[model samples]
Target: MKKVLFCLLALGFLGGCSTKEEPKDVTYDWAPPFEEVRWSMGEDAVFETLDLDEEDATLNVNPEKQRVFSFASAMETEVGMVAPDFIFEPGFGLVGVNLHYIPMEKEAAETLAKLEAAYGKSDDGTWSGTKFGELNLSDEQVAAFKKEADIDKDEPVVTIALNQDAQAVKYQECVFEGKNAAILEQVLAK
Candidate 1:
């Protein structure tokens, strides 16, 4: 009786000690809907000035080479009449999408003064000091911009051209993270 009881207790303890099965890994291979999505960068009031090469300016981005995407729209909207979008290719775990808007002629001085106070200085030499027009974004600012743009920090970036009206031309870029190919597919679908 003692032996039988001991055996039963051992079996019960062993059974209780058995390990649970691990969960199966999930694979995501289906491509995202990249074509159907079109994100608006808001109105021209928020953009800046950029110089770009007309011949090579397009959305298709090459990771190995340096490319310039410019947004200079609303040339006639206000005083200084300048709105530029500048995007540089991916580098240093960072991607840039800069917006520059110069108020029309009548407002250029005042607008520039305001911008200088807020951003820094305009690199265009329009200002005696450092050019605030040139963006020197901090890490926090970059992160915020990425969040606003819905881009992942780990992804490679692809450029997109928006707004081709004679008055304004805007540029955008898609930055991809690990396995972001799927996200790109989704963005292209819209």
Candidate 2:
């Protein structure tokens, strides 16, 4: 009877001393605020928030065409996910932020596979799953497109790109007719 009481008391004490915690307040919202949204905000805003410096980066700009600012090497910056070799364009009114993953490499195939599964496939093998989504490429187009984009050589590979844009923000990589774009050009020119 004493042994039984001791065991019961010990169990009760252990239970009382238990440190089972309610989950920590760990949470992540894939969707940030509209203004805080990557690429949906101004270029300076993005660079500021991400703690990136344009001057320290390798700048590739065409005053009359496109402006691409990339890090000398892969670095962690927040957006859809942490990606390597970040590329930023002023984009018109706050658009055109691209995260280049598996740059000039072949590991992006796994990432693309996951995307394909989530988004599903098109008859041509490019994802026709959603509107305003990444342009799907047919198998043939994949290789040729990479060559055209200078993503890879000798073989067709996936260079996973994440684009953040809002409906209100106009695409400006080619048009180059917006005030914001003009300002970017001026900055890039210097």
Candidate maximizing lDDT: 2
Q: Give every collision pair in model 2.
A: none
Per-model C-alpha lDDT, please?
0.34, 0.37
Model 2 weakest lDDT span, ten residues long: 170-179
The number of the candidate with the highest TM-score is 2
> On residues 62-94, what C-alpha lDDT tens digit does candidate 2 reach at each position?
564445565544444332122323333444333
User: Lowest-scoring 10 consecutive residues by lDDT in candidate 1?
Assistant: 29-38
Q: In each prediction, how many residue pairs overlap at the backbone (N, C-alpha, C within less than 3 A)?
A: 48, 0
> What are the runs in model 2 whose C-alpha is more than 4 Å off?
1-36, 76-91, 103-106, 117-190
TM for every model, in the order presented, reads: 0.24, 0.36
Question: Which digits, one per residue and each the tens of the lDDT, describe model 1 over residues 1-190?
Answer: 9999999999999989988533322232111112221122211212222223444334445464533355444432222234333233342211333334432444435654544453346554222212112224344444434443564444233331112122543222112122232222223333
